[model samples]
Target: MQIEMKNIHKRFGANNVLTGVDFELLPGEVHALMGENGAGKSTLMNILTGLHQHDEGVIKINGEERSFSSPKQAEEGGIAFIHQELNIWPDMTVLENLFIGRERRNAFGLLKTKEMKELAREQFEKLSVLIPLEKEAGLCSVGQQQMIEIAKALMTNAEVIIMDEPTAALTEREISTLFEVIRSLSKQGVSIVYISHRMEEIFTICDRITVMRDGKTVDTKRIKETNFNEVVRKMVGRELEDRFPARNPSPGETVLEVRDFTRKGAFENISFSVKEGEIVGISGLMGAGRTEVMRAIFGLDSIDRGELYIHDQKTVIHTPNEAVRKGIGFITEDRKDEGLILDFSIRENIALPSVKSFAPKGLIDEKNEQQFVDMLIKRLTIKTESAETSAKNLSGGNQQKVVLAKWIGIGPKVLILDEPTRGVDVGAKREIYSLMNELTDRGMAIIMVSSELPEVLGMSDRILVFHEGKISGELTKEEATQEKIMTFAAGGQ
Candidate 1:
């Protein structure tokens, strides 16, 4: 399969997202689409997949000029899209999701569950994907769900697969497996459109790279001919000397502390402290209770036994509001789901945390609210048309900035960030890191829970490794290494 998109142009009102962008995908090759957030990667892919109609473009598939009216049309044309967010019905079993809308039936119209399960198993085996066909899709791990999505695409006999950030939520082991699957598929003459912000993956797996910036296709090069710095320069239109900002100031007195925190079946004996002007990173494996401990501290989950102290004073927090009032803010992992209301305007979401401040005597001060949101937008460098724009309309990085703005508006003394840079572009990641540095310089304490080891090591003043619901070890900035962190995360002494 070969896909050629030439001179693609798309516009949303006055914002032209894709301006004459050209792309090509060759059979038996993994072609990477590289760009920063809102650089028109999604828009171009959406146009290719028929989710959005391009204002002007020429699409050729297999040497035939094609126009697709809907996603089903694109699928029927042998193009399948596996979005970053897996499109799986949580209540449905793997077998059911695999054969949806194309279920096999007997002459009496009875569903052929046995046949479907058998076929699903074959697909999984071919990809070396280990997942139970009987298990509910929602209950599966993120890595498993990603594999199921691929299996489902295989069921469609797709010749071209478009994967958007497929490895974002996967473990290193799972990522290795996925790369193997991609190689196998390429060997079988399948074309892949691999999109991601992780530069390492692009260099490791992609055969060719297309860089887009400001809605234009900058250049496409063979993977071997390009280096990381060149690709990043093309994507962001600037040279970023460092991926993380340097933290220089010494940490102040302890601002937040947890003593012997225990959550039955989730985490136990978790003890850590964050000093004013310090970044204390929590590192661990997926089920190692890093997130659970933070949730407990934020009062989002009940703690079976523990003690929390704010500014060295014992505190009791029964809910998120209580925690917030006590100067604690939590920026959750999934910004779209838990952090922000997508339908709400940026102004509304930013003002949600500080509603009381903007509203005196049960009435909103429109003037003050607008001023606050505008200041955050400018301060955070959020890219949006206006404060009236819906939160969902912003790019991934901008939406994250909005979440940060919300918490910042609350004037919290202690901020807990979970996967702060997850799914954000490298440029935005640097900006967020710089913002963290600025906040810490101003005497704010940040506790970051991150799966990215490089981020943990680069930005943290100290790291606390978690293993099996307990604190495995702690390392200072001068001592922390990826090997040591992994050792502690795996429960090694």
Candidate 2:
């Protein structure tokens, strides 16, 4: 299979998202599409998938010019898109979710359940996924659900598979399994268009790389010929001195303490403490209970056995509202579903956490809210047309900044961030790390849950390793190495 897009041009009202962009993919190759946020990567992909029409462009597959009117047309033509956001039917079983809208039926309209199950099992085996076929998709963890999305793409018999940040929600082991699956598929003559902000993954798995800037193609290079620094330079059009900002630790009294927290089968006896002016990182594999523990601390989950102390005072937090009132903020891992409302405007979303302040007398002070949002937009460097722009209209990085702005407005004493930088670009990741430093400098305690070992090591003053719903070990800034953390994360004694 050979796919070529030439001189692609697309515009949304006054925004020219893609202008004179060119892209190509060959058979049996993993082509990486690299760019900073809002560099028109998603816009170009949307044009190819028929979700949006390009003002001017040409698409050719296998030497035949093609114009798809809908996503179904593109799918039927052997193109499948695995979106960055999980798009599975949560209530349906894995098998049913995979075969939705494309189920095989007999002449009498009876579904071929057994045949579909067998096919699903085969794909799962190929991907090394161990999830139960009959299990509800929502019951699975984020990493497991990512595997299901991949399997669903494979079920389409797609020759050209487009994976948009497929590993964003996966752990190290699940990522390895996905890379193996990609290699196997490539060897079978399946061309893959991989889009990711993670530079290491691109270097490890992709054969060729295309860098886009603004609304145009910057350069394309063979992975072996180009290095990470050069690729990043092209993507952001500048030199990045360091991925993580310099950390200055000035510890204060403990602000939040969890003693022997337990959540039945999810996690047990998880104990930790976060001090003022400290950035504590939680490191672990997927399903290792990092997120579960944080949820319990943030009052999103019930704690069966434990004690929570805030400012040296025992406190009872039975709900998120209570947590918020007790000076706690939680930025969930799945930002699309939990962090922000998609249909809401940027100003509205930013004001959500502190709505009471804007409406003290039962009526919203529109002027005050707009001024606050404008300040956040400028301070966070959020790129948007105006405060009224929909959260769904902004780039992934900008949307993350909005989530941060909302929390910052609340002035929480303890902030819990789950996968804080997932799916964001390199520039934005640096900005977020800097923001963490600033927050901690102001005596705000932060507990970060990250699967990226480098991030944990770079930004954390202390690290807590989790394995199989337990605290395996703890390390200080000077003591925590990637190998040491991994050893503990793998359930080492």
Scored by CA lDDT, what does every candidate get? 0.89, 0.91
lDDT for each residue of candidate 2 in 1-493, tens digit (9 for 90 to 100): 8989999999899988998999999999999998988899988888888889899989988989987888899999888999888888899998888999999899999999999989998988888889898999999888888889899999899999999999988888889989998999999999999999998899999999999999899998899999988988898889998888999889899999999999888899888899999999999898889998888887888988999999999998888999999999999998888999999999999999899999989999999998988998888889888898999999887888899999988999999999899988998899899989999999999999998889999999999999999999999999999999999999996
Off by over 4 Å in 1: 125-136, 140-144
Q: Best candidate per lDDT, number?
A: 2
Q: Residue 408's C-alpha lDDT in candidate 2?
A: 88
**lDDT score, candidate 1, position 345:** 96
Candidate 1 global CA lDDT score? 0.89
Error of 2 at 290 (Å): 0.8
Predicted candidate 1, C-alpha RMSD: 1.7
Candidate of highest TM-score = 2
lDDT of 1 by residue, 173-223 (tens): 668878998898899999999999888899999999999998999999999
